[model samples]
Target: MDIYALQQDIIRYSKEIGIDKIGFTTADPFSELKARLVRQQELGYNSGFEEPDLDKRTDATLLLPGATSIISIALAYPSKLEDAPKGKKGERRGLFCRSSWGLDYHRVLKDRLTKLEAYILEIVPNATVQSMVDTGALSDRAVAERAGIGWSGKNCAIITPEFGSYVYLGEMITNIPFIPDTPMEDQCGTCTKCLDACPTDALVGPGQIDAKRCISFLTQTKDFIPMEFRKKIGNRIYGCDSCQTSCPVNKGHNHQIHKEMEPDAEIAKAELIPMLQLSNREFKAKFGHVSGAWRGKNPLQRNAIIALAHFKEEAAIPTLVELVKKDTRPVIRGTAAWALGEIGNVDMLSVLYEALEKEEEQEVRNEIEYAIDVLKNIE
Candidate 1:
């Protein structure tokens, strides 16, 4: 069997199936990544969403027995949203980061991988293959880097010359010994834009992130956002793109090739007040298709409350007051009280007093008391 000829055939078929970039590498244990993961764990920089076992994350052989080579694939997503709705005083909008603007990328990338697996099986009938996207044990960025998909950028994204850092990456491990491609040279070269632009200084150093402080991570957490980072979160409801957007390599690199990746003007940049009142079913119906909805409606609603405070959207006062008074979730009720304080108007004091009287949870009551103080100071 001519492995070289078969690799060529796979590449051609990949293009036909909508894969933007593909590369191959040996399935050697990722020694460097294992060390870094250890260091990140010691420093508490990991997001806790990653696979916990270091051996499983860095050793390709553990995931698939007899694994000889890995194939990495990338799909470019759009950066700019065309015809995005304008945010005005009363109708303020919060943004889900560009990566979440389209259909959930995990599903999109997995579909591509399944097709590739089927094609490979047809050619090499007995090939043993295993595949995964972001949630998988192997880091997609590490696999992409080793397979020559792109250089690891300072923002920790895989930066491809063709698609910039706006690409979604996935990988497949197989027994076929395909010749590896050369990794890309570091093109970032002394650019501190991404590091400087981080809202919480989450990028502690180039290519190293403290996920705990990252706005992208903070927005996804189910609990209360730390007070220090709450105002810095701005209007981001899902993920934060400040680091990627600040990079020089990503300039003018918006690609809208995939139809499923196109942004729905209203869904991508949704109204802040409306989000505060969405029922679980309503949230699912509107945003379940997007990647950011993985954490469900609570975190988004919490961020929406913070965003309203960021803009100090006075029109949202009534909705926020209602949330503080009646929202079932303590986090929501507390965050709403905090937002009301940030949006300080004399009239809101009456609502705060009413909530303070009825609020049973100590956390919610504390937030209501804080709001009362903020409003009283305004008078």
Candidate 2:
């Protein structure tokens, strides 16, 4: 097959599979990305993907032997109203980044990539094929940029004019040789909205993320949130989208307009009290199949407690009490104590005192004492 003809076929097949944007590139990332990844690791920004063994990742090469090019695809996950909250007065529109409102991207992309791989195999019977979503060492966004799909935004996300930065990236590494696509030039052009909109200053510079200060990381993390960012977390129970939301490209792509993905009622309008009440089994049942399932209930529950505390809603006191008294995870209990302190009520002193005595961990004990002090002062 001639290179030009083959490229056209691949694009047709990709669109047939429901992908919104397609781009191609040879398997070499520029030196700048490598340096940034190293710096990010040094500053503890890579903890999310730093596990000892990541099966889908490969660094020696983005492709197998005889590999000549890559086929990168972008899929759109439009926001849907079903994901929005209901009957909640004084609540800000529950903000879920448009990208995560639907079915899990891992499953969606994996299924689409599998189809692409099978199609390629049918044409080149002995062709080697490996697919990746966000799982691998391959830089999905970098590859997308090289493929001419879009320019990398200041938020460190791929920005497509048609879809903005609200696209999921996936790629296929192949042994078949093909012509590579020209890379796109940066179009972000002096725009600092994403940088200024960041609640945690995760975007230290253009295209640079500390991840350590990222709200997405904070909400997605398993450990207790660092005290510095707890108050700024707002009502975000899962992933955060402040930077993207503030981007001009992403302004009109909310549930009121786009309709590809639907949000869960519970998640869209997430009630701090109900989230606190979710049992382990219920938590799993509700979020297990979704991307939010990874951090399980602890982080989300913790974020919810903190959000309620920030809201200063007296209604949340009973829920916070249950968490402090009986939640098995000390991380949750400690955060519960912290939230109680922020909410500040006279009755909470007794609860904080009880937790302080029973609290075995120094961190939780300290938080409990702080809560006791705050409550006493409020009284």
Candidate 3:
């Protein structure tokens, strides 16, 4: 079998099967990535979401025995929401990041990888293969960068000239010895747009991120957003896009070629008030297919409350009061109290003190007291 010919065939098949880009690389250990990760750990920047074992994350062989080659695939998602509903007073909408605008990318990429896997296995009857998307120990960006799919950008995204940095990445490891593609040269060229645009200053340096301060990571956490970032998070319910949107290369690269990637404007930019009222079932029915929902509704709901505060939506004050007075989750109650402080005026001070007297959770009490103080200061 001509592995070279087979590689070309696989690339063509990938395009036919909906993969936007494909590249191959040797399945050697990612030494540079390991070093970077170690540095990230030392700097206390690791987001606990990653694979705990660093060894398995950087070595392809550790994941798939006898792996000789790796395949990296990119699927571009839409950047702009068509007919997006505008947020107005009494009708504020919280925005999910562009990456979560469609159905969860993990499923989308898995389907593509499965199709490619079957094609390769048919060609090489005894080929060993393993594939993974975001949840895998292997870093998809590291695999894609090494595979020549794109250069790692200063924004910590794999930026393909064709798709900018708005691409979803997934990878496969196989025993087949396909020729590796040459890695792309860095093209960022002294641009600091992404760095300057980061609201949280999470981009500690070019190609480096302090995940703890990253809005994308913070939005998914189940805790109350730190007071400092609550204002910065603004109307973002799931992720932040300041860095990506500010990139000059990404200005005109909205790819909606994949039908599954089309954003439903209503859900992607959902109303803050309605979102606050959604029961678990309602949230799942509306957002379960999207990747942003993977963290469940608590974080999204909490963010929605904060988003209401950001907009100073006087309309959501009633809902915020309800959450503070009756929500079972202390995080929700506390966040709502904080939002009340942000949005409610002097007139609402008495209502907050009333809730504060009955609040059982010490944390919730603190938030109510804080809200009272903020309202008083406003008077």
Q: Model 2, range 328-379, lDDT digits (tens) per residue? A: 8888899888888897778778778877888899978877887787777777
User: Which candidate gets the maximum TM-score versus the true structure?
Assistant: 3
Estimate candidate 2's alpha-carbon lDDT, on a 0 to 1 scale: 0.75
The clash count for each model shown is: 0, 1, 0
Could you estimate the TM-score for every candidate?
0.98, 0.91, 0.99
**Rank ordering of all candidates by TM-score, starting from the highest:** 3, 1, 2
- Tens-digit lDDT string for candidate 3 (74-157): 999999989888988889899999999888999999999999999998888899999999999999999999999999999999
Cα lDDT of candidate 3 equals: 0.92
Candidate 3 TM-score over all chains jointly:
0.99
Better of 2 and 3 by TM-score: 3
Tens digit of per-residue lDDT, candidate 1, span 1-379: 8989999999999999999999999999999999999999999999998999999999999999999999999999999989889999999999999999889999999999999999999988999999999999998999999889999989999999998999999999999999899888888898899999998999999889999999999999998787789889999999999989998889999899999999898989999998888888999999999999999999999999999999999999889877887779999999999899998787888888988888889977887888789989999
- In terms of lDDT, the poorest run of 10 residues in model 1 is 318-327
For candidate 3, the per-residue lDDT at 170 reads 95
lDDT of 1 at 189: 94
